[model samples]
Target chain A: MPDLLPENTPFAIARYTPDELKAALRKMYLIRKFEEGAEESYTRGLIHGTMHLSIGQEASAVGACMALGDADKITSTHRGHGHCVAKGADVSRMFAEFFGKESGYCRGRGGSMHIADVEKGNLGANGIVGGGLPIAVGAALSAKRLGTGAVTVCFFGDGANNEGAFHEALNMAAIWKLPVVFVCENNKYGMSTSTERSTAVRRIATRADAYAMPGVTVDGNDFSAVSEAMDAAVARARAGEGPSLVESMTYRWRGHSKSDRNRYRSKEEIADWMARDPITRMADMLVEHGIATREEIAGLEAGADREIAEAIEFAKTGENPKVAEVTRDVYTEAVQ
Target chain B: MNMDAGTLARPEQETRELSYAEAIREAMDIALAADERVVLMGEDIGVYGGAFQVTGDLVHKYGTDRVIDTPISELGGAGVAVGAAMTGLRPIFEFQFSDFATLAMEQIVNQAAKVRYMLGGAVSVPVVMRMPAGSGTGAAAQHSQSLEAWFAHVPGLKVVQPSTPEDAKGLLLAALEDPDPVLIFEHKLLYKMKGEVPAGHYLTPIGKAAIRRKGTDLTIVATSIMVHKALEAAQTLAGEGIEAEVVDLRTIRPIDRETVLGSVRKTSRLLCVYEGVKTLGIGAEISAMVAESDAFDYLDAPIVRLGGAECPIPYNPDLERAAVPQVPDILQAARALAGERV
Candidate 1:
């Protein structure tokens, strides 16, 4: 219950215990394996719609959510499987949702783009760009008004920084002193347009200055850097100080979606980002810190692989939603 | 005090005359007093007393915490209200003008309207949005259009147009009690209209029609401010030996089919009147409903629709009056449907 680290602890892994470090490494593996399995399912024709995979940006998701608890909430982006898993969602239910099954989190209504677990504090994965920004502020407002002492983390892509919603949400959050942290996953590109071509600013974090909030940019591939920044941001929000913006500089190795032709970027760029895989970095860090052996890290990855395999089985065997019950979830009251 | 042998007992319920705006403010006061979860959020709704002065003085009583004054950000404010509603707070969001909803349609249509269904009913967005609509105040095209038809087309949204002070209070209270997102389209011109509204708590059920007048020659179905116009037209028709029935459709989305159909069946004619544009508007849906139902067999004349003109609401008073269907337009349409000279 006391402080996890001493007063001057600067690094995240230095603050975390051996077991905590290992668990974090396992989550990063779980996120990587889940997306890989999803891609495989798509290739096998088991999945119908295209998905936005956060293949190489696992550390940003895991690290940003490292300080949050089950009570804390997160509003995620379209590429949100990492955030969902990082926030303690069951992968089987997630896979069930992706497969459009009744046992899924959204009862087959919401697919990959809208997966949500309210009980787990995953507000939802929004399909629209910058859609979750204002919603996160509202959630924070609810927390403040209800005296719940809960902090909300809003995850958006760099493209969202240009959206009107981003500015409005940030301004409102700052003015009302809402308990929220705006985490921008700067994945270099919004579909095909790179941040250089789309965004007006050199860095998205600097835009937070206009809203009068402290902003920080960190190496999103480095788990310790992201975790340290997020921990401080979340602490500020929970203390009723106000919202802060944390820009996670990362990249997606795969195409934006299944329909992406991969014509916008070169093969060299893809290989470059893949080489700095967040999962591999986290694994190596755990090993170097003496928290786990190489064999131990391999076992953790193997465990994630097994879990993903079982999740696919669960999703494949899940029951399809009935046609007669299609409109059942449209309203809390029965359809007139 | 002993009563005389032939004296009647006094009624327990109390009623008072209140303008449409006052009725709405009273409803908000009641909602805030009855439940701490209720909060009002809008631009200048606090000290400025709202652009239309509907939420006047309540902010003074309830404080800024309850009656919130949001910035001039419709899309973000609407989304925040939806999020708050989903997370246990009852937020009544007021749009400065109904035309401004275009900016916030992404949140209203995609996020608020579809969230519950998309999330498999895991959460309910019980947000109430108040939009001052219709083109009477000379607010021009940007500030004055009646855009309720667009919201009515959305499935998960409940759209209502309260024509009187009574329904304004009752229906607003009812909307707050609803578990789904409800949009109340208050015509700007009707804010000053007064009517006897019941004191204390009451509800005018959504998805029901109010038959303001009964006639046999033809049925004139109207919404929002047009309901008053239809009533005036019906009165003028009576003096001309043409009996026209007036039906006030309070709720547009889940339309009161039975009431409309029953009136049409008796009158054997139909005339749809609304301030929204004629093409692809609320009247189009009503006409289609009557034609597809068994009431089609009872129709003695072809259905007529009196709606706004093709162009935007003009700036000139005359053009503005001509743009939307006025009382004379409704009267002429009704007389024609009744096989009389316009």
Candidate 2:
């Protein structure tokens, strides 16, 4: 039995309504279900090439996104399905992207990774690991220059934390005092190698001191904790206090890519992580707090299941682009 | 020692000649003073007065912010320039040499070229990338290649390779004002060739080719420092009864195809000269265009291609001259193609 409540604790979990907690849980479950469907589809050859699934990192994505306003943006990584879902990318179009359909956001030009909608405040998902950092810097610069209050959140994995681009972008952001949040989803491992082995430091956030920015570590499995950390970062950026780095200590349940066989971890490690499942944790919290019953949660899950099935059906019917599109969008050709 | 020494000293043709480096400095001064948005950026560009002294005293005059000395990241600089262009700034990014462009190919080709279109034409990138190109300075294999042909292949890119001080000033101005990304290739050798450039704000259009000399025997198309060599060769060809017209294809991408074809129609013979290698060089593109057009039958001789040898641009001066077409080589190629000399 988990301890119900401790008298003296580190920091109190900020007050979240039962419905809000339930919504976060639903969002995490939606991301999980969507990614699982994508993984199975790729295995069955319905999807082409490679797909990066954010199966276990859903809480960090959902909670952080929930902290942002509609105008604030979130730049994604190659493992971007969770971020896309959390940022409200159209399910059918995202599905169509994997389906290699003309109706896709980039017309099948940018498959799973590069779905972008500036209007939705979701700067396109990047194929390069640390590529989003500079773009987010640019967006933050624009926001600062234009005097718009919008802030940008750049999301990347632990592997990208070592890239030169990451350091360069953060330095620029720090100097300019740009309104941005640098989120490092440290899922213990980068592809197959553990972050502890790859990174020289214990925590990814510790490196933020080099750039003169505030750094924080959060339990990414807990939605409220992630939300609290993100809220502070976002508020600091919006207040023009420069960028902050949030190291979300999370885990990925699946292998790196759809082709990964998961030979890196033991069964005990997998079960221990499963015991800390984000969606089930939030649901359990909601029920224990008298927020909602199990029947309502079950119905919401069923609704998401139906909607996702329909989205997949609609995406499968989408057509691939004409072969001649290869020449298009390379540049603004007709213009001088 | 002349009968009228003052009159001799005041010849109309003796206009003030300036080096290409001086001309570029003057252009930067004029552009920065004219437009508040124009800023110069590169490694060692500011207080260092630029790597080749092209931006002499610019940082002192314009301050450190306007004359930015960037860190040693080509990708970061180019990427920042793209973002800056999207904003209100008109950035003039300097590649230390043409060789470093490969490091920032994605930013140059993908982001800078595609941003406006990717955003449904919501923005424009008025970015200028000035690169020092070509061999003869003995900068070695990595830094001595002429890569104008590479950027010219991109659609949204404008390429300018100025032969003289006048064109360097005019083209730099035009590139700053143009709404697209323009690449200016300043040849390593031409930086010291003095010629009178018009004072104040001047511009040469991005698409027009300049006809250096008018004649009727053969149309010699050249670029960069080769333009001057072709002019000298044309004068030599005139002595051999081969009146060669010189056409400087200044802009390679929006290549002055019309000017070359029109000149070929009048001259009846054509020769393409460049410093890059002969295999699949810009010469081949010129040859194919001539052959595919109505001008093919008008050839007095097979279209002569006086290009650099198909080898790395060697550091040896004699080998370098032999590699690319020089004045004597151009003279020989012109006269022979005109059926006047073997």
lDDT of 1 by residue, A1-336 (tens): 126545554476676778888898899999999999999999999989889999999999999988999999999999999999999999999999999999999999999999899998999999999999989999998898888999999999998999999999999999999999999999999999999999888999999999999999999998989999999999999999999999999999889999999899999998898898888888877776667999999999999999999999999999999999988877789757
In candidate 2, which residue pairs get closer than 3 Å at backbone N, Cα or C atoms, i.e. clash?
none
| Candidate 2: CAPRI quality band | incorrect
* Displacement of the residue B298 alpha carbon in candidate 2, Å: 4.2
Q: Which window of 10 residues has the lowest lDDT sum in candidate 1 chain B?
A: B1-10
What's the TM for model 2?
0.83
Candidate 1 residue B112 Cα shift, in angstroms, is 0.1
Off by over 4 Å in 1: A1-10, B1-12, B340-342
Clash number for every model?
0, 0
Of the true interface contacts, the fraction found in model 1 is 0.74
**How displaced is residue B282 in candidate 1, in Å?**
1.0
lDDT of 2 by residue, A106-136 (tens): 6777778776655577766777777777767
lDDT of 1 at B261: 92
